[model samples]
Every structure is written in structure tokens, then in C-alpha cells.
Target: MSRPAGTKDVDYAQSMAILRTRFEWVMLIAFLIFLAVVPRIFSPETVDIINVMAIWVVGAHGLNLLTGYAGQISIGHAAFIGVGAYSTAVLILQLGLNHWWALLLAPIMTGLVGMVFGLPSLRLKGFYLAMATLAAQFILTTAFLFAMPGIVGGISGLTVPFPEIGGMSFRVPENLYYLLMPTAVLMTFFAKNIARSRLGRAFVAVRDNDLAAEIMGISLFGYKLRAFFVGCLFAGVAGWMRVCYDGCVRPDIYPLMDSIWYLGVIIIGGMGSTMGAIFGAIFVRLLHEMVLVASPALGSFFPPEIAGQLGSGLGLVVFGVVVALFLIFEPRGITHTWEILKGRIRHWPFVFAPG
Candidate 1:
């Protein structure tokens, strides 16, 4: 890790510590406090946006661990999220269970489902592995759409009650923000810790070279499955969050395009890092909002006949252009760029160049 001048690690403990200085600890605490109070500061619409960002953070983290860290390719992550959303709904509605219990079990159910699809990782890889997971997306979504109408609710989907306990409900935007943002923060902590642990190192090894990892006695089967399970587990948690936020669980909610966008999130945010997942989610969500706003506004500049076409088509064009620009110029993603800026700032005056 890069540090400011005079910063030195004298021991392994110091080197490994996330908050090495008083400033670091202070910043972390301040950030937490800010998150806690953000709903009070932002508009209700913006707060709702933040809630959605939280869901993306959780979903992106799952994909980061699997595709970015473990090198397992999946294009159907949203389907797993659907599994979680539907599972939670089923557990709560069909079984007469509490939403709390559903929350606990739904993610586990999704993880198990992910592991089943992950079986192909033992033999197939790359495009083949992606194809396998894509199949999972279609199969699971098909089931969600047509499985047991009485249980899964089929096309109309299931209606989930708002999260409530002890007479307090999180149905409103501000209250839901409190419920969601903290969960995203907790998941961030979990993902960061996982990235630095022994398991995380093993994941990196497998991602870099699976055969080499196996030669080094790393269990390819175990690690790959664990990656899929854990990643999909995050997706499940995100699904739960989304269902709770929307008050419904429908097949249309978790689309294949969403899974692709999650992949794009990690790619544009920088893969293989927890912060990358976060940065990517914020960037993508903000970009989405900006495009939505800008598309209609740009139509005003065009003639009436062309305005309608421009309004409908500009968003896709802008999205493609932005993604292309990032891929061409900043393939490492925003997190890597952030690190470089920090490095330059820290080394300014003596080692930094003017340009």
C-alpha cells in the first residue's frame, strides 16, 4: 500500500492494519457517521437512488469475487438474485414464516443454487463456463416465471410486505435508506476482509492460474464452488434488499441485461478489489441517472421529427460510447485510477512530475 511521507510499518500487524493512522481512523468514523445521516440530508428521490446503489454494491461485490477474483465467468448473476428474491418471498408467503427468517434462508438457498451451476467449473472454463451460467440464468428465470404459480406467483409475482419489527416499518424512503445503506456498508467490510484473508488469496491464485493453483495443492473444485456460492450469496442478499425495497418479487425484475450491467460495473470500476465494486456501482448508477436526464433534454435541441428518435436512442448511444471510452483508455477501471492519483498526491513536490 502506498502511504504519505514518514509513514512506516514496523511490524506485520501495522502493515496489515486497514486504519494505520489516526487520520485514517477518523476518516472511517466520519464516513460512517455521514452514511448514517445521509437520508436526512438528501431528497427522498435521491435517498431512493442511494437505496438502489446499495443493492448494486451488494450484487457487484458477488460478481467481483466470482468473476474478478476467482476468474469464474457468469453472465446470469441476476437470475441468482431472482432465486433469492423468489426464495425469500416463498419462505415468507407460502410457509407463513417471518420475513426475518426468510432473509436468513433466502441467501443460503441462492448460494446452493449457485454451487449447482458452478459444477461446470470443474471441467469447463472461459466461454464454456459463461455459457453454463447463462443457462442457469434462463433456467432459473424460466422456473421463476412458470414453475409453481401458487408458490412462486408466476407472471404476477409475489407481493412482499415491508420490513417491520417491533412496530417499526422501513417502508418509507428514509427508513429504508437506514436499513439498506448500513447493510451495504456491512457487506463492504465483509468483502474487504474476504479479499485479504487466506480464502481471498486462494481465490486470487485460482483466478490467475487454476492449473498452477491445483499444482500448488489448492482445491480447484472446492475454491471454485466456494467462489460461486459466496458470490451468489451476495447476489441473494441484494435480491432480498431489492424485493424489500420494491415490495414485490417478479421475474421481470432480475433481467439478463442487469447481470451484464453488473459485469460492466466491475469492469468499469476496476475488478478484483472491494473498493472497485463500490466505485463501479456509484459510477454506473450515476451515469444511468445522468443519461435519463440528459436524453430528454438533448431532444429539445433537435427538430420535432428527430427529437423523438433522439430521445429514445441517445441513452444507448451515450452508454455505449462511455463504456467504450473506459475500455479503450482506462481498462483497469476507476479504482486503479484513484490509486494512481493518490500516489501522485503523496509523492508530490519531489518525485512528482509537472505533467
Candidate 2:
């Protein structure tokens, strides 16, 4: 006997739901396996590249939370990251603190500093707000370079000692991967959850229209400060990671260009989406990596002097071109593109079929 129409529909819906759940689990497992094996399978240099990607992605997540979700622009986001790096270096190297303690304290310190700088947001908006952040960048950079040079190590920078975790020393890429990848995974999960929570909704409301959000009982100042704190916390953690992995903390490491690049990451990846931060970091970093590889290969075609210059500069040119293309054609970013593709796949044949 044929099943009733309602029963068939219900069975089909249930099957689809089960399939979706299974697919999600399978994807998560596959990704975890990849993270585990990638360092072992890849060369040491490739492992380094992956490590850099994770570090920057963590930093970009912070910017996305501020600019993408909270509609607050920070041209000096890298300064906060510098704070974290310097803080970690001082805490671990100078103060004789444990790596674990430095890791915990860096973000907290950075968050407090961010909140202080973020006070300007209460009075500024748009270009004015950007200028305030730009000032912050200059001021913090000066501090890093000149203010109490003995403390920040001035321009020479501070050496970062190897981190000891449990009984294992993280002196090599294979071991360090455990420290970084897990932190990245945890922070990304935290960002994702924040985006779906009540505060995340308030952030969206403020971004969409602050005045309306105010009328709806959302405190602009409070949310804005919280966003900055959270964002800087992420930057601080990433900065701490840099010190741990690179074995040094330099003032120039977090430059004005870096702050801009972080913003570009979110723009290219898609604003207001956690995955967009990750996508943007991977996309931009991969482009930089490819340029590094190809530039030397193309050097043979030119004079040694010219080849050297091209090798050094071509990456920036390519990065600029890619950013321009994304702005012109896909302003909503890669996340939006993914969503469209996903919707099409779900709807399938009828999506493109003629009437």
C-alpha cells in the first residue's frame, strides 16, 4: 500500500534533517583530522605558514567583532595587538612569569587598555572616530618605539623564551602546533557563539542603526566598549601567540599597515560573519604565500637587481589587486558568495531550470 501524502512528507523532512546533521558531524571530524595531520604531513616551512594563518585569523576575528558586528571602526587595531605582544614578553621574560600566566594576563590587560581607548567612541562617529583610532595607532607606536625604551626594549625588541606546557617544551613546530591550533579553534568557537547570542543581536541592532537601537533599549556606549574589549582580547591572544612562536616581540611587528591589512581581511572575507574572518585570513595569507613562491621563480626573467625588487613588491601589488576586485565585484564578501552557492546547491535543479 502507498503511504499517505502527509506521512510521506513528514518522512522526507525527517530524512533530510538526519542527513544534514550527519553531514555537519562528518565535516567537523574531517576538519579536526586535517588540523591534526597537516603539520606532520607538510614540511617545516609549510607548518610555519599554517601557524601564521591561525595567528592572524585569531586577530582578524577581533576586528570583525568590532567593525563587522558592532559597527565600530578601529584603524589602530594592531596597536592593541602590540600591547598584547609586549605585555606577554615583559611578563614572561622580564617578570619571570610562566608562559601560561602570561597568556592569561595578556588578553586581560589588552582588554582594559582597549576599553580606555574605546571611550572616544561615545563621542565620535564615522571619519571622526577613525581619526581618533588613527591617533591611537601613532601614540601607541611611539610608546612602543620610544616611550620608556628600557621597558618595551625600544626598537631592538625583546626576546621571547620557549613556552613549557605540562611537561613538554614547545621548541619545535610539531609541538607548538598543539598550542596554537587548539587556541584558534577555541577562540573561533567563542566568536561563533557570541555572534548567535543576545549580545550579538544587540550589536547587530546598533550596527544597523544606533539611534533605533537606543530606542529599543540598547546602550550604545556599553555595547561599543564591550565590543572593543572583546576585540582587543582576541588581538592580545594572537599577539601572545606571535611571541610564543616567533621567539621575539618587536615594536614594528604591529605596524599601521598591519592594522589596515586586518581591516582588509574582514572586508574581503565578509563583515558580520565569524567564518568571514577565517576565510579572509586564509585567502589573503595564501595570496601572500603564493607571491613569495612565484616571485623568486620569475626572478630569472629579469636582472638580479630588478628581480629582487619585484620579488619583494609583487606580493603587495597582487594583494591590492585582489582586495580591489573583491570590493568592486563582491562587496558583501566571500561569506555571501558561499551562502549563495549553498542555497543554489540546496534548491538544486529548479534553481537554474527554465519555466
Candidate 3:
């Protein structure tokens, strides 16, 4: 005799849960292996790009937590990243601290700062909250620019020393990859864990319906603030990595446009999905690199002066167009689209009405 429908659904859910858990383990192992041999398989330049993609994955995971899970909209994530990067520079250069100590402290400081800015979430929602954070982007950048120029390095920015431990220095992408790749992996693991935890569920509840979540005894204000703190903490770590990688921290490094791109990352990947953050980071960063390569070639078609100007503008234009396309066609982001594709492939040879 056939199983009851309810029993079949329970079986399906259990099987899916098991499959997903196994898939995550497999992917983590594969990614770690990829990092291990990345320098050997790719050119140094490509390896550098891969390193950057990993760092952005860290930042995007944070944004995914805040905007994706908690339903908060922010356009100033780069500010938190800036805070982290600058904090690292300040701590190491001014306080004469080691890179390891600075690294440990930067994210905590950024998270605290993020919590302060996140306070407005108690009274604001939607566009107003976005504007408030947008204001934060300007406020923080201005502080870096004009507040303590001598200490913060002002408009000139600060140089990050090559991170060294035990008299061993890391000055190459391959070397730095050893430190950054594992950090990214660990943070990604944490994000996955958070998504499955009680607090993560609380975040989802608030995102879905604040009033209902509050009625269920969830604290909307508290959860929202915590979401911002966690998200910004991720951005801070990414910023610190970038500073270490490039050996510099500048006000312009984490600009408004970059903040928009982070939002685009989660949107393109899939809101509220950890895998979505990874997919989004890879897709967006690769697209960025391609634009950089293609821009120079396209310049040949125009006068040198005009070409220089056009090349400068090409990245933003392309990014805007791509974001618009996704918003229109795949608002649920790449994760949802991938799921649909998989479903279609599995159920091939079946047809249904276009509901």
C-alpha cells in the first residue's frame, strides 16, 4: 500500500535535511581543497582575484544576515568595512600593536559602532532606516577625512605593514591566502550556524512580520540591532583583510558605490540564504574583474581622452544594468533560480499549465 501524503511529506523533509547537511560538508571540503592548491593551479594575478573573492564572501555573508534574514535594508555597509580597516591601521600604527592583536580587536570595535548606528532601527523602517544608514556612510567617511587627519592619515590614508608572525612575513597573495581563506571559511560556517539557531529564527520572524514576531514574544528592536551588529562585524573583517592585502587604508577605499555593490551581492545571491551569499560574491566579483579587463579593450574604439572617461564609467553602468535585470527577473536571487532549475531537471518529462 502507498504511504499517506503526510507521511510522504515527513519523509521528504527528513531526506532533504540529510541531503543538505551532507552537501554543506562536501562543499566545505571542496572549497578548502581549492584554497590549498589555488596558487599552484592559477597565475599569481588570478590567485589575487580569488583571494579578493573570498574576502568579499565574508562581507556579503554579514549583509545577508542583516538585510536577508532580518529584513533590514542598508546602503552603507562599506562604512563598517571602512571602520574595521581603519581601526586595524590605527591600532597597529599608533598603538604599536601586532597585526594579530589588531585583527582580533577590529571586528569587535566595528560591531559596537554598528550597534550604535543600528539604534535608529528602533524608530525607523524601510526607506527611513536606509537613509539613516546612508547618512552614517557620509558621517563616518567625513570623520575619517576631516576629524583626525593626522592620526587617521586623513585624505592620504595609512599604510598597513606586511602582517608578520614569529618573524615570518606574508607579503604575497599565496601567503596571505593561508590566513584569509580559513578565516572566510570559519565565518561562513558561523553564518550557517547562526541561520539555524534560535536567534537566527528570531531574525527571520522579525523580517517576516515585526508585529507578529513581537506578539510571539520576540523583541523586534533588540533583534534588529543585533542583526546590524553581526552584519557590520562581517564587513569589518573583510575590510581588515583588504587593508592587510593591499597594505593601505584610504577613505575612498570603501566608498558609497562599494556599499551599493554589497547590497547587490546579497540581492543577486539570494536574500536569507548562506549559499546565496557565496554564489553572489563569486558572481559579482568575477563580473567586476571582467569589466576591468574589458574596459581597456573597449577604450581602443574611442579617442584616448574620451576612452579614459568612458572606461572609468563602464563598471558602474554594467553593475547597474545587471542589478536591474536581476531585480526584474530574479528578485528572489540566484539561489531561488538555482533551486527552480534543479527542480525542473529532476522532474523532466513532466508538464503543467502556466499558472
In model 1, what are the clashing residue pairs, if there are any?
none
Candidate 2 per-residue C-alpha lDDT over 1-355 given as tens digits, one digit per residue, 9 for 90 to 100: 1222223324655554422355568988899999999877999888888888989889999999988999989999899999899999999877989888998999999988888888999999878989999998988888888987787799999888889866788878878888888999889988887887888898888889999999999999899999889999998999898888888988888899889889889999999999899999998889888998899999989999899999988987887888899999999899999877865664565464232
Instruction: Give the 10-residue window scoring lowest on summed lDDT in candidate 2.
Output: 1-10
Decoy 2 TM-score against native: 0.91
Point out the worst 10-residue segment of candidate 1 by lDDT.
346-355
Model 1 segments beyond 4 Å from truth? 303-312, 352-355
Q: For candidate 3, write residues 1-355 as lDDT tens digits.
A: 1221233324655544523444557986796797788889888898889889988999999999999999888888998899999999999999999788887899889988898889988889999999999998999898888878889999999988989868767788878887788888889988988887798999999999999999999998789989988988898888788887889988888899889999999989999999899999999999999999999999999889999988889989999999899999999899998877755644454432122
lDDT of the candidates, in the order given: 0.90, 0.86, 0.86
Give a tens-digit lDDT track for model 1, residues 1-355. Answer: 7777777788998899888888889999999999989988999999998999999999999999999999999999999989889989988888988877887899999999999999998999899999998999899999999998988999999898999878989999999998889889989899999999998999999999888999999999999999999999998889889888999998898998888888889999999989899999999999888877887788888888998888777766766787788899999899999988977887786455433
My TM-score estimates for the predictions, one after another, are: 0.96, 0.91, 0.90
Better of 1 and 3 by lDDT: 1
Regions more than 4 Å wrong, model 3: 1-28, 344-355
Q: Candidate 2 vs candidate 3: which has greater TM-score?
A: 2
